[model samples]
Target chain A: MFLESKRGILFVKPMADVPSLTISPSSKESGEWVQPSPPRPLPISSLRTLTIRRWFWWVGVSLVLAVVTLLTCLGFGTESISFSRIWFILVGVMLGTESIHVGTDPTAVILLQVRLPRVLLAFFVGGSLAMVGVALQALLRNPLADPFIIGISSGAALGAAIALLFGVGISVWSVSALPVCAFAGALLALLIMYRISSLGHGFSIYTLLLAGVVLNAIFSAFIMFLTSVADPNRAFGMYAWLMGSLTGPDFFTLGVLALYLGVGLMVLATQAQSLNLLTLGEETARSLGVEVERVKKLVFIAAALLTGAVVSFSGIIGFVGLIVPHAVRLVVSADHRLLLPVAGFVGGMFLMLADTVARTALSPGEFPVGVVTALVGGPVFLYLLTNRSMRVGM
Target chain B: MVDSKNVFSGPAYALRDVTFGYATRAYDQSESVLKDLTCSIDSGKILGILGPNGSGKSTLLKLLARILRPERGTIELFGNPLSLLFQADVARRVALVPQETMQVFPFTIAEMVLMGRFPHHRGWGGWHWEDAEDWRIAHKAMEDLDVTHLGSRLVTDVSGGERQRAVIARALTQEPQVLLLDEPTAFLDLHHQLDIARILRRLNRERSLTVILVSHDLNLASQYCDQLMLLHHGHIVEVGSPQDILRPDLLETVYGCQVLVDRHPQSGLPRVSLPV
Candidate 1:
């Protein structure tokens, strides 16, 4: 390494033939240096191609994994259904030709109505949270930044609790009560953070992060207070929801979530190049033609919407957003064009698999997927922090 | 006669009675860093701004790039008031390379340079993929800055001089009519510094790139800059050719130090050396 660096230093001295001490600027011609060299395969350009190819490879693998996970999750409920039966039923349902009586084969109703929506919702929520995570990390320009760390998830949780405990909205089919309330809560927290952080120079990421920590604590306390005042049955429901369950939402809820995530992902993916420039630093991004304030607002709103939509249903599944992006970044480059979608796919598969474990771990009782994620995520985050390569990259 | 309406008729940048300061809060006004400073930089001239630490050299560059809004006066870019142009419009024509950058995330040097083409990509929304021509321009920039070998390396992993060169390469990819650099040579070794000086000189002569640089290296400023603008405590002490500005008394007054100014042995540009 030393020898290579020494040679690099020597190579940087303009002309290699001239001795180091006696080199003169007049020896070089101006126009000559501006000319592009004969197109040799530069390591940099080749590395770029390699990265793009590797990204495509990861995307293909993750897509296959997502499908496999979706199929595998269908078979792992309290009452075990064979994989072939699940596959047959799924294919028949999709074709809309074969009908199985729910009365005769109770497994059919359980698979179609109960397990299918839960599994799909888990995947969608996971993907949404991961998307939010990737966008927030880039927007804040910090590797450790995620929706939970920035209070978006907690704020959404508080909103969901208020709606669940106090009955804040009428039960509407088009826009569900919980998600709407949660979305409002998330946006409120976002507005407060923006206002407080923007007090000094634009948006100070440290101040925003500190504000998020404080808000998260405050919101969680409010949730606790609400849980205490509620009746026993409602309090039990609140505890389960707070633990992050995917059991309650129906197909309609899933559809609403998928629609919101789809739009949010598109908006975020469009700003991928801007996100790339932003990672360099706000000043550099501004100098490179990014309207820093505008991009920040767009990214913040999109990330908050994604987190609220998912948290409203899933009750704040932690670490999918924080962990999946870092894991994807390890394999793929940090180009948001690839990073956002890849993180989503990987996150979907991961949470689906986690949900499967949660369903089968205690047979009928079922652990919360949030508990599984934290149990899994905590070690991984600590490892990432301690790992030399990851720390340096960060 | 110079046509008055032509874009090249007047100075590339004109700052008239400009007073600027950073705001401490949304409503709180901080003290002014620069006060009533007026200067004009003509087209294709290499103007080196020399000043001590905290003398507002970087602030001046930021003001020219329109990063900071002035509290008092008007700054004109190519005869148009700065307020008349959009931020993107200013970025398309002017590129500023700051002294040091904090990059919390890692990126390849090529990727870093490619970002400089942000303003040139013609699209309103969605992923603005760089075309083949953009890549060609970026590669040419790397070659010009002599950093092609470091292109694949992470920007955070390279030596300070290599990083400096890579940043300059990125600035070149902007293809700006004017390039403003703040302490571009501060981290570079002597040879790399000279290389940068020659490269800037070439770009000015061949491409008609109006260049403005801030530096603490007086000898370098004297050697390469066509004109020197000496600033002391946010005020311009002198603005003239190197021979006229690189004088013992003027530099001593501004710098508060004793110095000897003589012609270079070979180049005939003024050489500033401290008496030992």
Candidate 2:
């Protein structure tokens, strides 16, 4: 039945012509209506289910891939170490059998002390950023949402710049102080954006996004002004950090980062089902028994925490958060329970590879890992936008 | 399991002096959408709310679904104040099928339907995963809605009528005693509209589900609803059976347009039409 109005004419096909609405046997049983069955199911392949077993399978595969990527990237720095030696060193350290003195052997020192910590840091930071990306995207109901675009990274960067400008020494206190300041900055940004967006009772996604963009610009200006006024020697270091570098993190720093990321990821994981419901719509989620306000708050804090933790140590790495989750969603289903873990592993692997290239591509002189991600992420983002099959709208 | 039909002994919903308004930019003033409404909806009955645009029909349905709170009055569900009940508790008894929803991700129809079981999950930690029984109920809802074949299809990729069925299937999976629909047939064709009406009637007969729907289709409402209510300017103009409420004078006043009222030729139900 076509509907014609003064505004325009809408030609709706007759019910008999629409295959999806064809009368079914069950409906026919209720009355005298008889119609042909719906045509063969659309040729599109059915979406793969993430059963408990399949979820575990995919997670295990991604975990193995991440570990392999870590180990492989460890073998790439200035002084490349053979995989066999790296494996031996790992086993020796774990089993406590080989008394390989790290100070005496440069290879062991590089593999265990320098390279090992760096790779592990990369993995944790990457995983944290990606997980937060997935959460933020779900929270905002925008697939493009990520820590960097939403200003959390710049907020952390601003905090770190202040700490450095004040000449916070590299003592144990400074070690804790830098991250504390960054986390504080991230929380402040989160609160400000949340307040601005939620002024009308509930969050408006457009308002939240606009606030994030504006906050990012303001934070960047503050960071630039601080850097310009600081000493050139310190300003150089700040510049590199602003560009997002993962440089020389120790085991203690890695452990602390792990703790923060662990807590944040656990909080996000517990809200996985709620996240799935939220993607449908806030009212729909509320009707489905989800506490929409509570879930939003929890996810916001957790995402801020994860972003701050990673940005504090790794400076502002871009694209791992935005790209990894999106790519994983394409391969796996959108079920947050599976998407979260899988995206984390893939992100870890992605950043590890990017950092490896950054460190090794320029010989002894290394560039910021953020440069590599931006170079790769920029093109990939464009491709996703232009490619019809990417379907990145969500 | 106990039958939900036997669980509730009184009216499904009762609103007393219920008033709702949207706060405008002016701090001291507000625009009232529903004003001082008092009504009681019986169980196991289909109630259709009819009104012109902006008449608060949808707001009334939302209030009954517990999705909105009245500004100055009380709403009771199953003899208990709606405000006193937990959100999940309210959801478990009352399910709403919105006219449309924005889908940010491509969730499979089965996954979408399984979400209806969310209110049934136990525990405050939010760690509950859907078990076999949840899947069974979801599957059964799909079968009942004749959407079993669309289980693997994405809700975003389907036709409007199919998506509507999928959404209704999800609502059915909630296994609620009362179902609230906001313009369920607004965008549907005649066949699909009839299909939806039949499904609602069947559910009402089988499970004693109380259905309250808001619609502009006067003819469809008259054909399906046992009780009809007309509203104008946030006030209830008339509430009665189709025959009593579908009078030309009442509809003309509520809708602000002249309408010809006649009986449906086959069913003898009230039929409304615009006299061109």
Candidate 3:
């Protein structure tokens, strides 16, 4: 019937065209399909469900990955040392057993002070970035969406550039101001984008994505101008940051990042249900009793905080935020219960792994982790993008 | 579980001659999306809004949901003005089921459906086993929609028709006073469309749930709606019971197409046919 009526019937199946008189429409439907059903999360109710227990697998793997990442990061650096000595050195540092030197005095110090901090930063940053990826992906409702796409990274860079070059005299007690600057910038950009894309009625993702690209370019240009005008010394520091390094940031910065990341992560994770509804779009989300705007505001703040803090301290570590969330979604589905946390774990491990390779790929000189992320993520992302499943509009 | 009479027990919803428009761009001058639109909904009985494309069907729904601020009007939901309710408070009374059915994110059906409980819920925890009841309600909604088997399957992997039902299931999980569905059957085949129609009918009759649906399917509207509103160029063209409004003249004026209206043999509801 379809082929007879339409000229552009590119392909047709016998069953698709012919519904025989003998077979009723109701009878043709073999399965007793459930209609609009309720949400049932990963069943963790009993030990019997342990094998299929997805969270347990993530937790078990995360611990092992974290430990291995820690050791490998310490083991290979400017002066490569044995794995045993690296472990002993780490134990000594933890236990305050400062007497065991495995080889050169310089290598031991480098292992303890230089490599260890960088590696741990990678792990923690990875974890935080991935989790933020999950949150932002759910919040935005576009798989291609990320913290960067929303202009959070650009805003953070702007805030950091002003602080570093102009030496914005925010006192030590207002020490929280540096990251707060980044978070504020992110929130401000997000507000503008939201307002512009959603004037009245529903949001158009194409318009939003286009808006983001324009905003990103504008901010990137501004940052470039800041770099060009700054003193040579400041320019060098800015260069390191723009390329994204895991080098600087003291423990105080870590403490602050942890605090903000913790609060944001908790908030996003708790609203996992809303995030789930959001994937169905705003109207549906609201009907499901989600305070759509409030959820939007909270998730944006959380995503901005996560993105802003990371960019402020570690500089712009690109692709981890973009890649980690997609990876997690493919493996675990968009159910935020698992998606949010797993994105974090996977992100942490991925960054740690990337940073480990970056630091050791060439012993004396260091490579930027962003390059590694893009190199790894580009191919994988391409595969997902061109896949048959996504051809239909979401 | 909600009683219909209690919904408008003391004047639940009010919209006072609101006007909305978009600013002029280079190509087009300022234009109104909703022109002096004034309407109110009672607590019970599903309200069906029928219109052609670009006729402000979505604009009307957005105003009610408060996602988009109306340009020049006052909207009151359940006695309190829209401005009076906290963001959370408004969400408790109304829920919207949007049109986009294709889901890119692979949310499990359970997690997707539990989102309906967000207004009734608070705080920021990942998933509390203690909130097991919310999960149960979501599961029940899924069952009500007959989508229980697709619970574990990635939402991305499902058929378009199945995904649409899943989205509606999520909305049902919200347990709202009013349910607003925009193009609910836009993505479904005939079988699923009828299934949704039946489910919606049951919810309206049994629960007294107020349903406001924006659809292109005039037949479905005539069959299910207590009231049918015709819209054209962002204005309500005609409104009344299906029998009164489903005339050929108004249908042509609003839709810009030839339409034939006939009475159904058994139900006596208006049935519509369009030109090929």
Candidate 4:
């Protein structure tokens, strides 16, 4: 209510009043006529109450787009299925009215067992990576910060490569060996980075970034060595996995990934306000009553968990994490409470579409989804870097 | 409104032989920043800490704000040990406005100001949004700083003076009993510098706010500060009223270059100027 009058006055005031308030001697001497433009209306509140409402509206729109993308992507494989049949199949399966039999209708089996799981996997993985991107960017206070750039993905890949080389997943009881190892690798990398950065009293962003770069190089070399010594067939499979193919994921695997992502995302959600403060600078955040040390540690761990889990499932898909958050920030404000969720949804939709294009663009033979993401995301990232206006609040 | 009556019933801050240093590579030694600093600031007074660069002015302010811990001695805030209080508790009572801020996100001026309400949020782990009362307080602070019109503008996009005012407004939104500022008018133009000093003085008189600002501008500090504490090489050279501290010999000894010290013709406050 207070903001309404303030907003009214701001609008009703003549445009000339704005420039007159900031008149300088140089401007008067230059004799250049100052342009009169209305001042931007202050948001309804400083506490982001109106921005929160706008975020919810975006969330609703994103949810609809997600559903549409899911259904549309499900229809576009080598065996193209009509939207009506796909919808019926999904609804029937949800309703338990139609039984899925491989012999009777192979399309239902393919749709339910193959396309659905992969599409959902893509969504979850993309969402997780994007959330990690937002968290890391805030944590480091650098716009270029992402899971892939910071070497977390390389650590996970190295772990997965080790698992594949050792045939750890072949054992009946250890089907989750690859993901578990990958998670451990990612945590190890994060721990090392933390230790190195904290050696100088507190976490130094420069040292952390340098350690990441060094660790990435080391881990990638180890992964290469492991791949070279392994059997040809297994090595080829590892190569495909390393290139980030979203294929052959079952519902059980999807459920496990979802569980990990859900927990990690909840932890991040709780820290949204603190992250907003942190972006202002650590000292400033502390003076504003944030426990900077504790916040940094928790966010680092949460980001690592999200990165490790997603990389374990979908190998090192690049740019979604970096690009999605920036795009979302452009649309929405940098308030993490809004940025995190909206970016998550947008990322999920983006990856789903990319995966669709990856699978169907060249019929019968599918390339890795990583290629698709990199192709699009790399150029966009460069554009963001070069375009001064597109720089993320820096 | 802040209670004008002395709620704590003592000096705002009492430091007992406080020493602080940054740890160096050698385990046996540290780079000492502040050495055996003992001082007490009276309640509801504006105290200025003046020194050359690296004379530990900012470090002293940081110690008072509890952003850094003293390696030796004790700091008491309103008769209670500062070390005993939690950071959030300290923040609710004491707010700090740094010399300058480097923001990595484009938060609006209003949003930046409202961040001062962080310490006052009521919820589990303080995970709640600011209520209507908080918003009202933030709006009032913005109006006081004359930044209400620029509330929607991004902090990074505003002029240096507007940004500084927004920072001060944020500190005000904290509803602090004691305010610590590092170079409150370092890069500000003369108009904004006077504007900021006047605002602090008004707040001090109206709310009985205790303000300790670290500054290098001797004239501004002499004009506005109720008391001046001069430091040289991590040690206090003198602590007295502006008339006593702004002496030519003492200022020259502390600053190594200052010369002229005279009364301002208008305010009659001691003013310091360099001789060419």
Q: Residues B1-276, candidate 2, lDDT per residue (tens digit)?
A: 233446678899988999998776543333548999999999899999988888888888878777777899999888888888767788888999997866656567777888898889866424566777877788788777777677766665678888888899999999998999999997788888998999999999988899999998989899999999888889998889999999999888777789999889999998999999
Off by over 4 Å in 1: A1-45, A49-58, A99-104, A172-174, A191-212, A387-394, B1-7, B25-32, B124-126
Q: On a 0 to 1 DockQ scale, where is model 4? A: 0.42
Per-residue alpha-carbon lDDT of candidate 4 for residues B1-276, written as tens digits (9 for 90 to 100)? 233235668898999999998876754333548989898899899999988887888889889888998999999988878888777777888999998886746567787998898888744335666667888888889877878878766666678778888999999999999999998898789877888999999999999999999998889998899999998889999899999999999888877886898799999998878889
Better of 1 and 2 by DockQ: 2
Residue A289 CA displacement from its true place in model 4, Å? 0.5
Q: Under CAPRI classification, how is model 1 graded? A: acceptable
Q: For candidate 4, what is the TM-score?
A: 0.89
Q: Candidate 1, residues A1-394: lDDT per residue as tens digits?
A: 3322332343233333333343235445443343333344354344342245566787888899899889888988788889899888888877975553343467888887888889999899888888888887887666767777678889989988999988866477546688778887888877776567546444444566678889999999999999999998999988988889899667777788888888778778778888988887677777777878888878877877787788877887888888998877655656787788888988898899999999899987898998899999888767655655444322
Docking class of 3: acceptable
Model 2 misses residue A338 by how many Å? 0.7
Listed in order, each prediction's TM-score against the native is 0.87, 0.89, 0.79, 0.89
Error of 4 at A247 (Å): 0.6
Per-candidate interface DockQ score: 0.33, 0.36, 0.34, 0.42
Residue-level lDDT of model 4, residues A1-394, one tens digit each, is 2332343344333433333345557879998776543444344443333254676787888889889989999999999999999998888987987664442588998898889999999999988889988988887777666787678888888877887689785446735777777877887876776566446434444455577778889998999899899989988988888899899998888888898898889889888888888888778888888888888878877877787778878888988888898877655667787888888988999999999999999988899999999999889867656765434343
List clashing residue pairs in candidate 1.
none
Q: What is the C-alpha lDDT of each candidate?
A: 0.79, 0.80, 0.71, 0.81
TM-scores of chain A across the candidates, in order, are 0.82, 0.83, 0.80, 0.83
